[model samples]
Target: MQKFNVTPLLVMLGALGLTACGSSEQEEAPQSTKFSLGVSDAPVTEAAAVVVCFSGIQLVGNDQPPQSFTLGQDSSAADTNDLCRDAAGNVIPNTRGIDLLQLQGAASEALISNAEVAPGNYGQLRLDIAQGSYLQRLDGSRHPVQVPSNQLRLNGPTLSAGGTFSYTLEFDLRKALVDPVGIPGYFVKPTGLRLVDNSEIGHLEGLVAESFLINNQCNVNPADERAAVAAVYIYEGLDLPIAELADNGGTNTHQPYASTAVFFNNDATEYQYAIGYVDAGNYTVAISCDTTDDPENPDEVNFIVTKNITIEARQEPHQLDF
Candidate 1:
């Protein structure tokens, strides 16, 4: 059995307890709602999909001990498995996005900072996909339509201890198959119920270090840009993020050996991405040990720790044999 957990973060999550309580006083213990949904796809025509709807989302937190929620099953996994469907029956990840959710920690009622969520009545939701293509829905006239990731916003948001609500979402494969309806690649299907717990489960499982070098690559826009940038993220080998192994091979840390941002100093706005090397592994190598190289202005180069890594590929999150 391969061993993997959020070993790095365990110390940081020390003695977590419920952060806040709402004024409801429970009058009799606030009631919570559970949403379960069934999702399917249409005959593969032009590549469109539908999204489920959600409403009235509540945050369940407490005072003494911290809590966590599991998905439909007690996987105790992060966004990869803990997805939820709405009472109206739409699927969403049980997290805000790939990176926002985690293994063990306090979940407060306050809005998450830099949380990746569609604005609306959302309590940490996401979408997960296997390997095929997801289409986009275009109109409400249809069951669910396409909505840009950036356009997703909340109308009014308030979360309290032990409060609950309902929500909805739709999906469209057509729009997504076309030019515009593109949800970020990191999006995964949402599950339900954030279980409260402190015991640690595996963080991300799958091929941890998968370095692919694609040559003869096709270009999206050959005119304006010369090359393209790509990335390899860590998860349960699923879409939910575990740790980010930048193209340069950073260990979730932006040191010189690895970096999450494709461009330097742009970590704030610039997406956490990577660029595939010419040989996939070999090319102009960079490690962010110290901000030595100037992104815009060319400067001298140094090998912070350009290690040549080689490994065998098998069903990852590899098993450990005794």
Candidate 2:
């Protein structure tokens, strides 16, 4: 019965206006520049699978218009079953969603590979995660995960000619997959989405000691439930106020730059958390157990802990053990 809180939270191309130097032939058609749009995620500890049905992915450039690339129709990685429908209950192609769970622990899966487009100073990337986006439990039951507006427009990054720009769409599953009070199923708000340039951001990784995991007081767990790290909160500054650590959107001013839940590795002997595509800067990391115990009241400080560290450009995963 833990009420987890996350209070925090690419493109482009070129033209058919071909490049020709008055040559005999059209310079091999300008080679149709490619843009590789990838999909990745921060960790989500609560579910076995966070499956999102991405209908399409597009890139908008400063000079070039928005161009959409075909989704996972050819990849064996995609689930092409008719899980979606139109307003009139007609079935539509389920071409582009990725099981973000499969991309956990800073792993990335390509949504579009060498997608041919007019390359220019691309400013935005659009993702359509329409109806049929859902989650699967460890027990195998499925529940619809609501995506507000169903369209995500990520603004940042630029693509250029003959350059393969790699962009990773990160889904903060802990923050996105939220279970409201008295709500039957989890409702996913779009607030947890991030579009990061993989080449520019740093990575953060660490392990939560067994002592902290042993102290978890979350209301639900199975008999074999061993130690697990619940969530990690990363704030922009190193001097974040202690009060802000518990402030999960209760205050308009306090918010995290990025946040995600922690999960155990395949062996399950130790619990680890990882965050990818983090910008280089100083950040205050807060770790918390998924507990229903109210932090509004005193005596629950152990449920959450904070650490301050600095990350550098293109740095390998920075370690912060707790």
Candidate 3:
């Protein structure tokens, strides 16, 4: 119920060639290869539902300008669901963006299935999103979400002739949504996004006991605890200097890669956090619970701890406790 359909809008765009990828009128028809692109999301804590409505996906390579692919809505696939629809009451595909948060536990919704393209050195992949996408708050309120330029250009994986390439476009909602103070709605920043081979990423899940709080108290304000999780951050390198985290949770710097809010699961009795799609490499996990009252230099007196971990390609997420 979190997603809203914009099928007529998508069909309208496709008719105008606005979603078309290539425009070469005299280009020869080369033997096309197949590339399967899917979309997924890292867990976010700001809202109950993060819905994005995509209309088309375009693949750009060295041999061609770009090739457009239709996103049909099919629910049989693991990534496809009933969250989208067309005028005929059929589930639309890639054309309708999904609640990336809904496709979790390494699940990805297929964006392009067996998309045919000129086999060559593909450099970029572009995704076209509809203008109707919005975020649904926990209290059942909806707010308009902004997309930068209405498209995302990602580094594409190469597709060899007569071969197939598969990749998943992972959206990091924690870092992507900018909730500026005094701003009523959130803005979607695509720069924090990344595309990775489905086999080259790992999931990280961990637990934070209630005693993990700063001086036995949740550092979060009393009014902000209604959501499912508490704030937790992830960085790329080892331990990051306190100066790097000096900002008021601003992720303007490039050091911080992704973040997830830890959920206080009622059944588990612990704060559980999960990073659904992380590239295989070294990473530092940080949790900040203020132990001091200083607001300017909060990082100096917070119950912040960093854990260095190495993730292997396709390895099952191991529990990292604090």
Candidate 4:
């Protein structure tokens, strides 16, 4: 069996506590509301760290002026403000540097807390990315990550008055982060990005039995070691055929909604995998030891285990083991 290393990157932004502000003289002015926003990521292979520095965030909607915010100067979360610090431990003026790999599987870092904005439907949310974003490989080599336009524009959700709303922006790096043919640095595309309401999302986790790995002739690494010899692929609908399951590429008909590597956990003494920020719905989950999945191209892979599962909004994580 050919052991394949699998890694996927996800960016989740949860917004909460949107309360209306007191109005005064300007009846025509839009009512202001408060919301909290945070970011999180899934695991990745081959890279020790993927750091992105966000300079600012902008919200554009309702034909009103764009609401812009600088990272530290705005109402930043105190606890997570240190995440924007530089090598000398001083907070960078307007940028927030986040290590996406450090936050995996239900873990997140707060960016802005109780930030005020106009209450209305927003069509675009722009992330102003700074230069110097880079990826550090396992071998300790660092390469710059180039964002095409220095910003990422994602579809925004509607913010109503007197109600709290949470949303997540998922970035599937497997299909979005790519290396150019002759370019020296890596590139980040907007292809695999998605924005979903957090209130309608749930989590998924499970263990892969040792006997199952052995039966499939997988490389059973030590329990204490971390290796991506296997992986779990998740599709949006249930009972999907194993032959039609696809990678993270765009052209595939059955492209995976999300995927994560299965690695041995020392604490549990079992191989485990966890996928977070999944939209609540029916899904088909498949496990493969011969996981030679290439996000840029469709590849033939053999699945040893397949099952159907349902996820409910705000419910406890669904577990499906092989």
Indicate the TM-score of model 2.
0.72
Return the top candidate by lDDT.
4
Global fold similarity of model 3 (TM-score): 0.72
lDDT of each: 0.24, 0.64, 0.65, 0.72
Q: What's the residue-level lDDT of 57 in candidate 2?
A: 71
| Over 4 Å off, model 2 | 1-33, 61-64, 72-94, 179-187, 215-229, 264-268, 291-303
Per-prediction backbone clash count: 71, 7, 12, 0
Instruction: Residues 1-322, candidate 4: write the lDDT tens digits.
Output: 9975443222111111111222333455656677666676656556677887778878888679998877667654323234444446566566767887776666666666677776888899888877767888877898888788999888777888756666666665655677777889788777766676778888888989888898899868753354466878889898887777766653556878887777777767788888878888999998887545556666666777689999988747778898
Model 4 TM-score is 0.82
State the lDDT at 177 in candidate 4. 74
The lDDT-based order of candidates, best leading, equals: 4, 3, 2, 1
lDDT of 2 by residue, 91-181 (tens): 5675555678777556788776666667666687777777766777767787777666777776746666677666777876655567666
Q: Which candidate ranks first by TM-score, i.e. highest? A: 4
What is the model-wide C-alpha lDDT for candidate 4? 0.72
> Model 4 clash pairs?
none
